[model samples]
Target: MISIELIRKNPNIVRASLLKRGENLTILEDIIKKDEEYRSVLKKLENLRHERNVASKAVAELKAKGEKFSKEVKKVNKINDEIKKLEGVTKSIKEEINEKLLWIPNIVHEDVPEEEDKVIKEWGEIPKFKFEPKGHYEILSKLGADFERASKVSGARFSYISDKLVILEMALARFAIDFMVKKGFKVFMTPHMVRSKAMYGTGHFPRGIEEAYKIEKEDLVLIGTSEVSLASYHSGEILQNLPLRYSGFTPCYRTEAGAHGRDTKGMFRTHQFHKIEQFIFCREEESWKEHELLRENVEEFYKVLGLPYRVVIVNSKDMGNAASKQYDLEVWFPSQNVYREVVSCSNTLDYQARRLNIKYMEKGKKKYVHTLNSTLVAIERTITAIAENYQTEDGHIKVPPTLVPYTGFGEI
Candidate 1:
């Protein structure tokens, strides 16, 4: 939620930001009017309450003097009733304003490039194939990996990652987790099912609700990323630690409801997949620093895996609703002859922590903590990158050297 104080103080700034996000400024203007009305009603209620108190005192003094006070007492009671009615109106208007403010996106960072980011650096070379390279679907089919069998059991956009692929997925996840853990992140395997509060706290609800799988009976939703669970785990709590870092591994589910006919053939867009997610809660002053550190960690992980990848800062229009600033790491896909986004790092600033009430107590002060999250690895896409970038001439997949120990094989 935007700070109402900020909105009240600088409506112009708020209006400009809303315009940048392509929001309906009419809604914000309505909120401004409603806030004014609410304030007027609140003043009326306070004055009436004050008058009632004075009248009650007069009634008490009259009774003490053994004089008639029934009329004054009745007037006070009537004023009290009117104040109660105005209070209800005030409460309703306040709720209306808050709901409108919640829908507003965060203001983009000033330093974020106004234009789409250009690749600043690239690592490794796109693997050259002796023979025509096959996409993951073809390679998996030859290895007897069965999406058809998975579909028979669970329906489309599902797969049974069988044969060596299952091991490969584990290797990818384990390798990413280990890499993050060594970099001061506390590793965790978080819950898969989260309450609606968790979803809203992470800014997944209200915006991405349709893309989530809700457990209506339990009033819980399957998380789309471990970032959701990890970021919201400390919701409504005050952190004693200044910089709380957590890296989580979990199986995530999404409906992919909006992507009709897109990446429909393979695991490129799936209903369920494993992910290693990085989440951080830090002091507001340190959030941007942590954001870059998170990006560097992702880049180093991919670099160690010998994947050709580059980092690009996301543009405002494409940064989504939650992220104030975002950076994406796109790995080279040999078959596609282009880079595809595999990891996203974002500084949500206080956008999420304010909603979650995840705050921290400084030595002598209290404030909302800033939150940041990044994808260390999403298993399906990472596997896709590996399959395409590390394919051998004879159709075997080369396991990245960093994951060799985890998979217990040099090649798959």
Candidate 2:
């Protein structure tokens, strides 16, 4: 949520940022008006209660003097009724303001470009294949993978890994967890199901609610990524630590609602898949540096895995709702002859901290911490890229040198 103080202080700045995101800032006017009305009603309630107290005293004094006090007593009762009505108005307006604020997205960073995302850096060579490249699914199916069986049991867009492919997924996950833990991140295998507040804190709710799977009876939703659980773990708390990093692993679930025709042929757009997410909470001033550090960390992981990738800075309108700035690592997909996003790193600044109320004390001053998250690895997509990029002409798979130790073989 944007701080109301910010709106009051720089309405023009807010308005321009929203316009860049293609949103109208008039909603802030609605909030400001309701806020004024609420404050006015509160003032009326205060004066009315004070008047009622004075009338009560007058009535008691009249009774003590053995004088008629019925009119004073009725006036006090009427004042009490008026206060109750004003209180209701105040409550309703307050709720309206809160709901409106929840819908407001974070302001974009001034440095973020308004145009399409620009490539910041290109790493490794884009492979040139001597033979015609088979798409990930085509080659994998012939190599004993079983998406057909998964569809038979769970319908389209679901996949069941069989034979060596299952081992590749485990190797990639284990390799990532090990690599991240060595860099000071606390490892957490988060709960797959989370409450709605968790979604809201991660800026995935109220608007993104449709993308998640809801368990209505339990009042829980299946998380799209462990980022939601990791971000919400410290909600409403003031932490003693200055910087807390988490490497979270989970089998994510999404309805993929309204995404009917995209990536339907493979595991890339699936109802369920595994992921390793990087989440950080750091002092506000150091957040931009931390954001870069997160990107560097992912780059190292991909480098060690011997994958060709590029870093693209997401533009203002493309950064989504929460990130003030975002960077994506798109790995080369040989079959598509283009790069596909395999990891995304975002600096949400204090947007999530404001929403979640996560803070740290600095020199006796309590302040909201900036939150950042990145995709360390998405299992199926990484496997797809690896399979497509590293296939030999003889129809064999060569595991990355770094993952060789974990997979117990150089080839799969």
The best candidate by lDDT is 2
TM-score of each: 0.95, 0.93
Off by over 4 Å in 1: 113-118
Please report how far candidate 1 places residue 316 from its true position, in Å.
Answer: 1.2
> Candidate 1 lDDT, tens digit per residue, 230-284?
8888888889867989999999999999888887666778999888999999998
lDDT of 1: 0.84
Candidate 2 local Cα displacement, residue 222, angstroms:
0.4
Best by TM-score: 1
Deviating ranges (above 4 Å) for candidate 2? 49-76
